[model samples]
Target: MILIAESGSTKCDWVLLDTLNDKRINTKTKGLNPAILKKKEFKNIISDNETLSEYKKEIKKIYFFGAGCNTSKTKNNVHSVLNSFFKNSTSIVEEDTMAAVYATTSTPAVVCILGTGSNCCYYDGKSIINKSISLGYIVMDEGSGNHFGKELLKAYYNYQMPQNLRALFESKYDLSEKTVIKKLYQSKTPNKYLASFAPFVFDNKEHSFMETLINDVINLFIKNHILQYTDELKTVPLHFVGSIAFHGQNYISNQLKKQGLNAGKFIQKPIDSLIEFIKKENAVLQS
Candidate 1:
């Protein structure tokens, strides 16, 4: 049996695949970014997950690709937790963007992530040749859900938002400045809290201001992250993954086309693709 996981700042999807019977089980848990959570907390999160507990001992290998597994220290933290959780299983920690690469295509391409956080990379078919240093939500989650949500909140609080939209936001969320501040500073998962507002933005995308906002956000992402790759990378297709990309596909596609770029695929979640990649790779190993 093997377990594969894709994790973002907000949540994680875990797939348990029993090779013998070809049985599969899907499970979800709150995000476990090693960069954000401590080892004990990470262990607790896994232990509390009912699905993990059910097959902890049975799992022979775990392929974990996550948001904060970029650095060695972060990877070690997650590795320690997984090791402790499933003593009989071996764990491999990897970056979330790499998961996007595997999910999108096997050939060389530029892969971008625009979910609760943002990142991009140059994948040369077999390996990642280049990538940006994603500075997390607070500093540089540009074009992500958190970025859109933060912009919306700022505009609303500053009275720059249209009265109708402001009224709609007030009526729908009933969130005061005090509540927002408390959640941001005191809450554990502030990124998730901020990203929760993305749905409202997408729903109002037809609005003039919304179109401008989305365009600006997407443009900034392309300029700052994806454009940094080598000139050779520009020749390949550009693939995207995450909620923001999937939701704003049309807008993103238009922006890319305007810039003479080709849009490849946009996946809201990469679990299915990850599952397929893992299955194929494991099958090859066995053969």
Candidate 2:
């Protein structure tokens, strides 16, 4: 049996496939970013996840792609937790950027991730060659959910938002300055807290103010991430991965078009494509 997982700061999606019987099981659990959680906490996260516990013994090979898995220290910390769970299974840990590359296309392209967080890289059809330094939500993540959510909160608090929208925001959430500040400063997952407001933007998308806000964030993303790449990398189409990019396809595409760039595929999740890639590679090996 093979278990493949794709995780961000918010959640982890797992696909457990029994190759011999051709059976597949899908499950979801809380997000586990090694950079954020300590080894003990990471272990607790896996233990707390009911799905992982049930499939713990059955899984023979584990492929984990996650945010914050890029660094050697974080990778080792995560690997240790997985190793403890599936002692009999071989585990491979990789960064989420590599997952995006394999999920999108094999050809060279500019790959961008606009999920709970944002990241961008230049792929040379074989490997990631260059990457924009993701300064996290506090300073960067320009086009990410948290970034947009922060902007929304700013507009609402500053009294820049239209009255109707402000009323809607107050109706849906606690717009109290104290609550907002507490979440921003004291919460363990502040990014997720901020990103929770993105749904408001998506729900109120038709409004001109919302439209302009979305466009501005996307434009900044293009300028800071994609446009910073060399001309050669920019020649091909730019691809996107994550929920934010997938749902805001029309707006993102329009923004790219304005800059004379073509938008490539938008994959909301990469585990399906990652599974297909592995199966194809295995089939080739057998042949």
Candidate 3:
């Protein structure tokens, strides 16, 4: 058996492959970003999952691609935790961008992630060239869920959000300054907390204010992340992976066109495609 995981800062998707019977068992857990989560928390998440715990020994290999696993230090943190949990398995850890590349396209293209966080990488069909280093959600992650969340919060607090929308927002969430401050400053996963508000924006996306807001966020993302791969964009389509991209496809596509860039597929969940990609790689290796 083999286990493959695709994780963002918000959640982790797991697929257990029974190679002998050609069966797949899927399960999920909260995000396991080694950069954000403690070592004990990582162990607890896996141990608490009945499916993973039951199949721990059965899994001989684990391929974990996740956010915050870009650097060697963060990668090894996740690698060590997986090794400890799945005592019988050898784990391979890589950045989430690689999973985005595998799931989105095989040819040379620029892949971007717009989930809890945002990142862009240019894959030349051989190697991933990241032009900018992700400083995480606090300083970076433009055009992402957390980015949109921040925008909405700012608009509401500054009396910039329209009265109708502000009323709706206030009704739905506890936007007390005290509560918001505690969540942002004292929470373990502040990025995820901020991203939690993104759904409200999506829910009200048809509104004029939301339309303008979405455009601004997408424009910034294009200018900052996609444009960095200017040379690559001219030749290859720009691919996207994550919930924000999936939901905001029309807005993203329009913005890409304005920038004279081609748009590729928008994958809401990359776990299934990622598994297919891994299967092909393994088959070729065995062949």
**What TM-score would each prediction reach against the true structure?**
0.97, 0.96, 0.98
- Model 2 global lDDT (CA atoms, 0 to 1): 0.88
Residue 94, candidate 3: Cα error in Å is: 0.5
lDDT of 2 by residue, 1-287 (tens): 88888999999898988888888889888788998888898788788878778889988888899998988999998889999988879888988988898899888888889999999998888878755566688899999999999899899888999999999899999978899889989999999999999989989999999999999999999898888874855477688999999989999999988888888899999889999987786678768
lDDT of 1 at 208: 89
Order of quality (lDDT): 3, 1, 2
Q: Which parts of model 1 are misplaced by more than 4 Å?
A: none
Q: On residues 115-147, what C-alpha lDDT tens digit does candidate 3 reach at each position? A: 999999999999899999888898999999999
Model 2 TM-score, 2 decimals:
0.96
Report how far off residue 148 is in candidate 3 (Å).
0.6
Please tell me which predicted candidate would have the highest lDDT against the true structure.
Answer: 3
Rank order (by TM-score, best first): 3, 1, 2
What is the overall TM-score of model 1 with all chains considered together?
0.97
Candidate 1 residue-wise lDDT, 1-287, digit = tens: 89998999899999999988999999999888888898998889889988899889999999999999989999988888898889999999999989999999998899989999988888888888655566789899899999998998988888888998888988878588789999999998899988999889999999988899899999998888877864855578889999999999999999888777778899999999999999999999999
